[model samples]
Target: MIRLARGATGFRGPHEAPLPRTEAALFRAACFTAAMEARGRAGEMVPGEVQTFRRAALSDGYGRVFTALGHVHLPVVAFTTDPVREGEPVPGFADPPVWAQVFETAGLRVMGVKELMTPLEEVDVSELSPAELTEIRYWKPSCLGDVLFNWWD
Candidate 1:
């Protein structure tokens, strides 16, 4: 059943679910690493240190997101090859278009917040417990990014 969280963020949840495309995660890892390298942010990154893995979310259709959570101290970095306006800030873990292009050229499709948010109308909560939903209500994610990637302590 699809339901919107009763909070200020207006996040819709439990939409029609699609399993995370884990196969693309490693490609995303390479893209992220390349972006970091292009930005000179790879100085501290160890090869194979950028890990791509999935995590469960309380309010999302594709509750499991394939992401790279290492090689930097950011809470979480979601990679995507979606086009970005010049100098436009990409939500979640994204670099510049030039940097993103590297992965796009390689034929990898990493989901951005927009792509991730599109399936909000198709949420299915059969798997989530009542406690999890309650916690999500308290969190009040401001955007899909918050729900998909976070460091909730």
Candidate 2:
């Protein structure tokens, strides 16, 4: 089910849903890091900033939270693939445009792209045929830092 936090605004499609708490926590950490990096405070994050980010995250909800730092909107998309078992290697894409086309075919709009610093096990595209990857059930938020961060934040 798609659950919206109080006062949040964004597109909530039939397939979209609120992020789990663990995912939300990780996204919060990533937002804090991105916001700090933009401020030249890379290694020093204060409680006040955390508080602000937490507020924004809660207010913005899970699907597309906008940070206080500005110009950065969370990118929410998931690939259609089975969950990666432990010790399994993550899949790689040689052509991003084609990879994106897979998502487009599944009814998801490709907002922006960002490289994952850490691999996410929940989003495993290894076993999916190109056709299977275009199914709606395969798309959802699989990891933190999956969204893009701009210089403003």
Candidate 3:
């Protein structure tokens, strides 16, 4: 499992408030991306795609913590937080050891833990095409997950 927290970077949404730094918030975002990929819609997520992702994420017991908090919405822009500086304590919001134990108990190997920072620019306003933007948003988190998991291999 990858643990993420808010740092110098921040996130914004098209029609909602800024992303919170709470564990539930991070879990929800991760689960949303996971759900999108699971449904093979990792390229573009339309407004209607939300319910499907919600249902899929909720089906996984680990995601219940987020679902129980109420409705979950897709963020238009999500910047990963900056990596924790070496020798610095991990943020309280992202307790890596705790998360590692949780995944271990679930029989999942923790390839690594990552702290995601939001990009400095507005991804939504980039010159990239809409499809490209969507694809980036959909795959960013999973890409990080893959990289972290394989870093030692």
List, residue by residue over 11-96, the lDDT tens digit for candidate 3. Answer: 33355444433233443444454444334221122221222111111222233221111112222121112332223222212223
Best-fitting candidate, scored by lDDT: 1
Indicate the residue-level lDDT of 31 in model 1.
Answer: 47
Show the colliding residue pairs in model 3: 79-117, 79-118, 80-116, 80-117, 80-118, 81-116, 81-117
Q: What range of 10 consecutive residues in model 2 has the weakest lDDT sum?
A: 144-153
Error of 2 at 30 (Å): 0.6
Model 3 alpha-carbon miss at residue 140, Å: 6.7
* Per-residue lDDT value at 102 in model 3: 33
Our model 2 lands, by Cα RMSD against the true structure, at 17.4
Candidate 1, clashing residue pairs?
A: 14-123, 14-124, 15-122, 15-123, 16-122, 16-123
**Pick by lDDT: 1 or 2, better one:** 1
TM-score (all chains, Cα) for each model: 0.36, 0.20, 0.19
On TM-score, the stronger of 1 and 2 is 1
Error of 1 at 98 (Å): 4.9
